[model samples]
Target chain A: MFLGVLFSGGKDSVFACRRAMETDSVVCLITVISENPDSYMFHTPNVRWAHLIAEAIGVPQLLWSTRGEEEAELSDLRDAVAAAKKSYGIEGVVTGAIESVYQAARVQRICRELDLWCYNPLWQIDQVEYLRLLVEEGFEVIVTGVFAYPLDESWVGAKIDDRLIRELESLQKRYGINPSGEGGELETFVLDGPILKKRIEILRASKTYENYRGRLTIEEARLVDK
Target chain B: MILIVDLCHKAESLSKYEFVDPIASIVRRTGSEFKVRHFSELTAKEIERSDGIVLCGTPLKDDLRARRIELFIWIRDFDRPLLAICAGMQVVAAVFGGEIVPQPKIGLERIEILKETDLLGPPGEIEGYHLHNFGVTLPSGFDLVAGRAGQIEAFKHSGRPIYGIIFHPEVRNKWIVERFLDLG
Candidate 1:
């Protein structure tokens, strides 16, 4: 059966897509862009990188833009997924929802309404183990946003490695971080992956720290053929 | 190090929800360690082996069954410091002599600390997220620590180390988590 993978260019979504491809042919990658500055639904302000990841994965990418506001954004997502499913004749959809029942439940509801099977392969996996596997699998990931108190601008562009994993373990021992960034403590963007035929070259970037939050903006980036 | 008891299978993922990073930041700031494991992973002996215990929030709406009863018994006998948020708070109330009944759907709201307690720090109002339908009616000997709009927002067992807050401190302001880490 053909499936659509929800691509966020994040470790979780990439891993989920990888696993889904192991069992099913994923036809399209879907991403939702939010215009709202304080949107809770969208992962980041810009998702242009997601387009490159979709290209690397050898799948058609669909960008669905929304206001990023709560209920309205959710509606837009539901519509987007439904449209993708219909247009691509997809039988199912895959998500990388590690936690957050609100997110999972909403997606499930949309899938149910669209009459498409919803697959969340990484739903209940241990967060620490999941993070470790991402590193072990040679997925080159970098921190793009730091919203938690302990994480600062220093964490931006930091690679996910053994040292970072150890730090996560230590943080878990001390602060109650999920170690997986499941609690919105941090956000990441994958620059390269196993399925990637090219690497992302960041042309220009800037880090802005305000209100104890650090956001790394990718001013310019392009996919370089490897 | 902080020991968070994973009550429900889905509750473990609550750590991945909002404010997870900030909580991690606090942990890193304090140079402490934290671990999230299922309740079944801990025995009575293990329960006694931590600096502090945080009962993570669960999606389970009600905890009035036999399994919950057994778990509550274990928590009551365990004399370690405890902090409960959202569903954790409801479980705490039910475990103690307090009662948990359906309350209004109050989303994110500023919690006014009615009294100064070490759990929340010097008395001041703080913004906290509330996503539970159950509210607690404190039993005797459990003093209320904080509240919002006349609701029993937070309460601590006077003679024991158990504490419960109706709102999610982990998802709220960083100070609440800082105070919780201080317990460790």
Candidate 2:
């Protein structure tokens, strides 16, 4: 079965696609480009690089825009899935929701309305395990933003692996934050994965911090050899 | 608050996404806290601190069985609200002189609820998903509250909040643990 992945150019979405590839043929990467940085349903960090990341993964991407309003973002996702079904004949949609019932339920409802299967391989999954599995499966992910205490500007552009997993575990014990950043504590981007044909090389980037939260803005990135 | 004791096999084939996540999700959905620890790492102090405890599933490795048996004794003595699920239940039964018989491979099997208990929801027929290579023949004190024929589905400690269920409650009857939320 061919499926369209709801991509955010973040770690969860890319990791979800990788897992989806094991059981289904991933037809396309549907990325929602939200203008509102604080959008409730959509991920906005590093979303501009969806095309490059899609190229690295060798999947055709469908980019859609929205105002990123509260409930209206669900419509944007529905439209993206509808387009994927029309263009690529996708039978299902994949999302990277682990612990967020808000996101998972909305996607499920949208899929039900669209008459398509909604697969959430990471639904209600343990974040510590999710992050560890993401790394153990040979996926290279970098932190793009940190939005919680204990995870400050230092986490920006850090790669996720065993060492980072340990740090995240420690942070989780202290701050009770989501190890996979499901609580909006942090955001990530995948550079390489099992299904990716090429790796992403970050050429230039900058960090901006406000009110203790910091984001890594990618100025330049390109696909490279594995 | 709930404490989910992890007995999941840590073999290379198994990731850390133990069956406890779904159970913890139920706990979290009910606006409670959940803390997870490996059976070996768990201390009696933590057990005393938690409102309830969950003994999650794991492969019946010889080493795991030994550790789980030790933990089961400690859990029984603590006398806290406990739900021993799947292999966790087998460990509890094995500690009580019950025989753990390796069974034929089976899938979903509906079991009749012989009596009412807070551990399992409702009183009538309930379909449970089974995926175990082993089942327990209970000792003298344990009572069979729910089962399908000779196969024991659930057993109560006769006095405590402790329960042992052969089938996986997290998958099929997720609402099975809803009663456990109010336990603590």
Candidate 3:
């Protein structure tokens, strides 16, 4: 059956789709962009890069943007999901929900209202192992946002390498940071992965550290033809 | 010490405001130690040993089938100093005689304290962050500790030491955390 994958370009969503591909055909990647800087609903500040991930996965991507701070965005997401079902004729939707019941429940509600099957492949996987698998699979991931102590701007451009994993482990041991970067300690974006048909090369980038936070701004990025 | 129960199935994706930073700040301010244990990881011994419990917000909303809900039920019996945030608040209410219903879709609304209890003292209106669609209405025995804009914003168990606030006090104000710590 054809499926619509809720693609956030994060490791979890990508990994969820990869596992689902083993059993079903994923037809579209859906994402929601919230205008609010501090959105209680959708993933913020890092959603701009979702397009790159959609391109890498070589699937038709749909991004729904909303001015709704948090809950209002749910209406936007519902509208997008409905449109996707009508246009794509997909029978099921897949989510990369690792832990947030708030998100999973909302998605489930939408799916139930639409009469679509909701698939969550990484529903209960261990956070540490999930990060390990992302690295093991050679997904070039980088921290794009930081909001917790012990994780700051220095981590913005840091790669998800063995060294980073070790640092995360140490942080968990020392400062209660989750090794999976759950608890909003950090957020990431994938630059390259197994599903990518082309490589993304960062041509121009600027790193800024201010307001007790750090960010790596991609001034220029391009998809290199394979 | 505070024990944060990780009810989230995907704990990694939650924001720092929801769990990590608030707990860390509370620990630092109170000079108290804290540990995070997932619901699945906890043993009966661990539950009994907890002095003060903080139920961290889960990505999952009110899912009756969620295994974490069962764990919450087990913890409810312990009757230790308890605090539940967004999803945690909903779970606590559900465990008690309260019900969780969808809230109006609003962001950063003003929550007026209707009455005073030890939880939010002096009974004055304060602005608080709201991110949940569900609200709690306690049963007969539970005393209404606080209210905001006509809804029951916070409550205390009549028969137990249990307390809950619908708004995220830890994320909004330090006094809330301080008060919870004081209870312990």
Q: Where does candidate 3 chain B have its weakest 10-residue lDDT segment?
A: B58-67
Query: Ranking by TM-score, best first?
Result: 2, 1, 3
Model 2's chain A TM-score stands at 0.97
Residue B23's lDDT within candidate 1 is 43
For candidate 1, write residues B139-177 as lDDT tens digits.
Answer: 667888888434888888887767888776655355666
Q: Each candidate's DockQ score against the native complex? A: 0.03, 0.06, 0.03
Model 1 Cα displacement at A131 (Å)? 12
lDDT of 3: 0.70
Work out candidate 3's RMSD over C-alphas: 8.8
Worst lDDT run of 10 residues, candidate 3 chain A, spans A120-129
Per-residue lDDT tens digits for candidate 2, residues B30-99, read: 7888897877777778888888888876532323564447656775475778888887788788877787
Tens digits of per-residue lDDT, candidate 2, A128-179, equal 8788888888888999998988777778888998999999999899889889
Q: At residue B184, give the lDDT of candidate 3.
A: 68
Misplaced by over 4 Å in model 1 are: A1-6, A10-30, A33-74, A78-137, A141-191, A194-226, B10-25, B33-35, B59-67, B104-107, B148-150, B181-184
**Best of the two (1, 2) by DockQ:** 2
**Candidate 2: lDDT of A91?**
78
Error of 3 at A133 (Å): 0.8
